[model samples]
Target: MVTDIIAQAFVDFIRRVCECENLWKAHAKDLELAKVGDEVTKAISEGVEGEYGPVTVKVRKKLLGRREVRVWLYGNEIDVDALLAEISKARSRAAWLLNDCSENALLETLYKYEDRYLIEVAQRNLDKVKNICAGELPRIEFGEAPAHVVEGVVKGVRIYLSGHGTSA
Candidate 1:
């Protein structure tokens, strides 16, 4: 029936969002490794009118703390616009799916997603509070990087869903 089809579509949308989050998290981890020692160089030559130069920059391998770990390559200048666009598309799809469902079903789905959002937010908040209370920030080892990015994706999707237009 139409209801079954709509339910399936919603399930598929959720699956796709999870897959994208995983993909982005993996990509972020790779980028963290790659960005170490990334270099930009500037060449400057004296010109008659003024200084004319090409700017180049270089990055060195730096230890990143827990706070720095949150600053991943995923939201960096390189692909953030594309990432946001993709999230917007997902939100639009979720909204359209909600429209297709009956009011009761839509409300159920919204409640479910909202619960998931709240659980994730609480977990993150607890982690931050624990860190602060412990007086030790989480350390970012190579293995810990992807989870941070995945958490970021969860927060982003939650924000998108809870924001102005999508609210129940």
Candidate 2:
């Protein structure tokens, strides 16, 4: 029964991790949109500041003549070409920030959330969850016999239990 409970814990941990990740992915697009907008705004503001000495700028996307967006610096039209370049630079910056997250760093963050979620769902002590599913278990043996398989992600590596032992 204890073994069953532990096995269930492992299953539940994996499910929650996947669920959390799916939820994150579903919202990722919205976050990206927000990031792009913020970056564009900052880039335009900085460009305008550099050229016009720190004046407030408002941006509008209209079917303007030969430009992607129109900028109004305190109720006056600014150079459309310059504004377009600023938009391009901002988009590239946002893309780089979104894509440059180190895999290890992202996995570390995921692990922390996975642990928290598992603990909440299992109603188990934090340490116990870490031992069972967080890959702290060197080798899992149940009631004097080892299980056929135990699989999980540990420190950004996938671990699988084999007949001989565990392997990455």
Tell me the TM-score of each prediction against the true structure. 0.23, 0.31
Model 2, span 35-74: residue lDDT tens: 4454446656444332232223444444753224445433
Per-residue accuracy of model 1 over 1-168 as CA lDDT, tens digit each: 433333343333333333444444545533333333122111111111111111122223356621111111232433323433444454454444434432343234335434344333333343332232223333312223234444543443334344423431
Off by more than 4 A, model 1: 31-168
Judging by lDDT against the true structure, name the best candidate.
2
| Collision pairs in model 2 | none
List per-prediction Cα lDDT, in the order shown: 0.34, 0.40
**What's the true lDDT of residue 163 in model 2?**
18
